[model samples]
Target chain A: MNKNRLTERKILVTGGGAGIGQECVSKCLSEGATVAVLDRKLDKLEKNLEKDVSINSTVLVEVDISVGEQVCRGVKQAAQELGGLDGVVNSAGIDLVSEFDDMNWDDWSKVLDVNLTGAIHVCQQALPYLRLNRSSSIVNIASGAGLVPIQNRVAYCASKAGLIMASKSLAMDLASSDIRVNAVCPGAVDTDLFRQNIRDESDIEQVKSRYAMNRLGEVSEIADVVIFLLSDEASLITGSALAVDGGRVFH
Target chain B: MAGEFFIEFEQFVMKQRKVALVTGCANGIGRASALSLARSGMDLVLVDIEQEGLDVLRKNVIDLGSRSAVICGDCQDEHILDEVFEFAQRDFGAIDVLVNNLGRSAREHASSFLDSSPDTWSAVLDISLMTTLRVTHRAAPSMKRRGWGRIINMSSDTALIGDEGLADYAAAKSGLLGFTRVLARELGSYGITVNAICPGAIKTRAHDHLKPSILEKIKSTIPMNRVGEPEEVAGLVSFLSGDGASYITGQALAINGGRYML
Candidate 1:
C-alpha cells in the first residue's frame, strides 16, 4: 500500500497480452513499479487493458521473448525506455492438450521454446541491469504440474520442471551478486488461457476438485505472492520455488 | 440473560473454530510457536514447563476468544501426554492442528565434542527430536481418521545453515526435517500434511544481551534488513493449516526474512 515497496523498479513481464500476465502488469503498476509488457498481439494486449491510464502508460513491446534474437533486442529497447531494470518476471508460456504419445515434436518444441528457453533469454538480457540495482529479484512463473507430474502434459510438465530447477541453480550461481532468482508454482487458476485449454468442462471441474480448496485459484492471489517475492520483504528468499496455488499438492 | 448469552456463545464457538495442541510450548521457539497458532482462530492447548508464562498465554488465548488448555509437563511423559489428549477431547473435541513445537536450545554446554555431556545431548534430542515422534505418533492416527489435519514442527534455519554453539539443536532440528519428509510421504495418501517452519534470530526477550550494533550488522546481512515478528510467522502457519496448503507436504520452509534462501 505504501506503493514504495516496488517504487522506481523497472520490471519486464513477458506474454503480457492476456490472463495472468495482464494481472501481473496491473498489480505491478499499482505498486508503483514501472513495467514493460512483451507480447505478440497488439490488438489483444490493448483490448485486455482499456480506459485505465495507469496501465496504458506501461511500455508495450510487440517482440516475442521466446525468440533469442528478438529477446536480445527487445530487452535492450525496453530497459532503455524504462531507464533501468530491477526485475524480470518470465510469465510468458503456453499449455497444450495433447498426451505424451500423441504429442508431436513441434508441440514439444513450442512448449520448451516458450516456457524454458524464453525464461533464460529474459534473465540473460535483464541480469546486467539487475546487477546495478540494489535489490533486484527474478520471479519465474512455473506450474504445479512441474512439481508433481500431471497426467497428459508431458511437454508442458518437462518445460516447467526444467524452469524450476533452473531457477534454483541460477539462485545458487547468483548468490554472490545482489540479484536474486525464484519461481512461483501456481495451480489451476480461472485464467482465460487455462479455460480455453480444457475441451471438456467436466475435466476442468475434475481438476478443481483435486485441490483442497475445491475451487479454482484467483489470479490476484498468485499476483499478490509474485509481488511479495519481487519486493524487499522477500529479500532473503532466493532459489526457493514457492507455490502460489490454493494448496494444491501442498508444496 | 446470562444463560442465553452462554448458549449463543457456545454455538458460535462450535462452528468454524479450529483447535490445536502445541507441544514444547514452554520456552524458546515453542512458546512463540504456540502464540502464532493461536492468533489464527485456533483454540490452544499450550504445553510448557514455565507455569507463569503458561498462565499469561492461557489468558491471552482466551482473550483471543478461543478455548485454552494449559498442560505443564515434559512432552515425552506418556502419562502426562495421555492426560493432555483426554483434556483436549473433553475441552475442544477433535484436534484440527498439531504443532510439534517442543525443543531445547543449549547455547553453553557441549561446545567441545570431547567434553560433551550425555545428559545434555539426551535432553536436547528428547525435547527437540523425539518429542516430534511421540506427539505425531499419537496425533497422526487421529489426523488420518479425520482426513484433514496439519502437523508442523518448529525447526531452525541452523539446520540448513549451520552455526556455532548450536550443534545439538541443529542435529535435532535436522532430524525433525527427516521426520517431516517421511511423515509427508506416508501420510499423503491419507490427506494429512506435514511441514516445518524454520525461523532465524527473532528479537524475543531471550537475546536481551545482544548489542544493538551487532544486531544492526546482522540485519544488514539479511536482504530484508529486519527481524521477523511472531505474527509474520503465524501468517505462514495459518496458511499451512487451511485448505490452501493441502498440496504442500514434507517441506522445510525457512521464515528467516531472507537470511538463508535455501
Candidate 2:
C-alpha cells in the first residue's frame, strides 16, 4: 500500500476505539491520510493505539456520533484539526445480541439510534465539508446481518439493513458532488463481539461449523474493505452494500 | 476480447493476487477450479468432505507454487466455513476471490423434486445456492476494501435449461444465478464484481452415476457433440476471477458448449 495514496487527505472515522473502526483508522493512516479518530471511550482509543503505530499519524477525539450536538462539534473540531475533510467513515455503532420478541423498545431504539441514526448524523454533519472537497467519500460499516437475516439479533439486523439502504440513497444524492457513499456488510468478524458470542455458546466448535469456509473473519479483514471503499482506486464504485462474511450467507 | 478489458483484468489480477476460498473441492468441478486459480498464482482455501481428495488438492496447489490450505468438512456446516476463512487469511492473507464450486445430490434424490423429501430439497439448496451466498458474503468485504474483488459462482446448465428428474438441483442452481445478479448489483460499488458460471455436463463420478442412456441423450443435444472437460469449465472460472472480466458483473456466463444459452 502506498503511503501517499491518502497523503495529506483528512479522514474521519467514528467508533475508532476498537474492532473494525480501529482497523479503518490505522489503514487510513497507513495510506497517508491525516485521520481523526472519534469514539465514546477516550481511554479505549488510547489503549487501542498501544498496539501498532502506522507511518501515517492520527488525532483522537472523544465524542459519541449518536448524539447530534456531539457529532456536529466533533466534525467541526476534526475538520479544523486536520485542516479540512476529504472523507468520513461511519464505523461507530452498537451491537445488541437479542431476539426481536424478547427485546424491548429501548433495545430497538438503541440499536437504530446508534447504528442507523448515528450514521445519518455523521453524514449530515460532515456533508458541508465533504461537498466542498473535490475528492471525498463516506464508507459505512454495515453487517451481513443487515443483508441476510441473522437468528437472534433482530434489532441489529434491522438497523444494519436500514444503513445499507440509507447508504445507497446517500450515494445517489451525492453522486454528482463526487462524494461516493458505500457500506460494508461484514459477516461474523473475529472481534470482541465474536469472542463474547463464542463464550456464550455451549459448543463453540459446533457454532464455527456452520459456515462452508469453516471460520470467523478478522477485524483487519473488514478494515481492508473500508480502506478500499474509501480510496480513489474505487472511483467508480458507489451505492453498494458489500459482504465480508466468510461463507456464512452463501447458502 | 476487447483490448482495454484484457489489459485491465491482467493488471487487476497481477496487482493483487488475491486469495480465493473455494467450496466443494472434494472432486468434480470445484477441484478443477481451485487448481486453475492456483496455477494463476492465487492462494487458495480449498474445502471438501473428502479429506483424502483435499490433501491431494493441497499438494497440487503447492506444486503450482501457490500457497494453499486444505479444509475437510461439509459446506453445510457454518463452523467449518469460519475455519476455512480463518485458515485462508492466516496462511494466504486477505481473500480477493471466491469460487462457489460445490455440487451434490443423493442417488435416489436425484430423480425428481416432486418425489424428493423436504430434507432433500433443503440439502440441495444449502449446497448449491446457500453455499454460494455464504462463501461470497465472507470473502467480499476485504475485496471491497481492497477496491477489487472477484466472485465466480458455479451454476449448472440444468438450472438454466431445466431438468425434469433433477428438479431440486436445477432449482438450487437457478436460485444461485439470481443470487449472483442481485449481489452484483449490491456489491458493485465497493469494487467487488459478482458473476455466475454455468457449466454443462462434464466427466466426473457424479455424472458417471447418471443413467448411461440419459447421458448419451444429453451429449446428443450438444452442438459440439462431446462431453465437456472439468478443466474447460475451470478455464472460464479463472477468466472471470481475473482482471479480464472487470466490467462484467450481474452476468451468468455459460460454458456448456452450446448445450444451453441464456
Q: Top model by lDDT, which number?
A: 1
lDDT digits (tens) for residues B214-237 of candidate 1:
788777756556676655565566
Worst 10 residues of 2 chain A by lDDT: A242-251
Model 1 residue A123 distance off true place after TM-score fit, in angstroms = 5.3
Assign candidate 1 its CAPRI class: incorrect
Compared with the true structure, model 1 gives a TM-score of 0.69
| Poorly placed runs, candidate 1 (over 4 Å) | A1-63, A68-89, A94-113, A120-138, A143-180, A186-236, A243-251, B1-13, B26-38, B59-67, B112-114, B162-167, B201-232, B257-260
In the order shown, the chain A TM-scores of the predictions are 0.95, 0.92
Models, CA RMSD each: 6.0, 15.6
**lDDT value, candidate 1, whole model:** 0.77
Error of 2 at B128 (Å): 20
lDDT of 2 by residue, A24-87 (tens): 8877877778888888986766766667574236677888777788888888998888888888
Residue B66 C-alpha lDDT in model 2: 83
Query: What is the alpha-carbon lDDT of model 2 when measured against the actual structure?
Result: 0.76
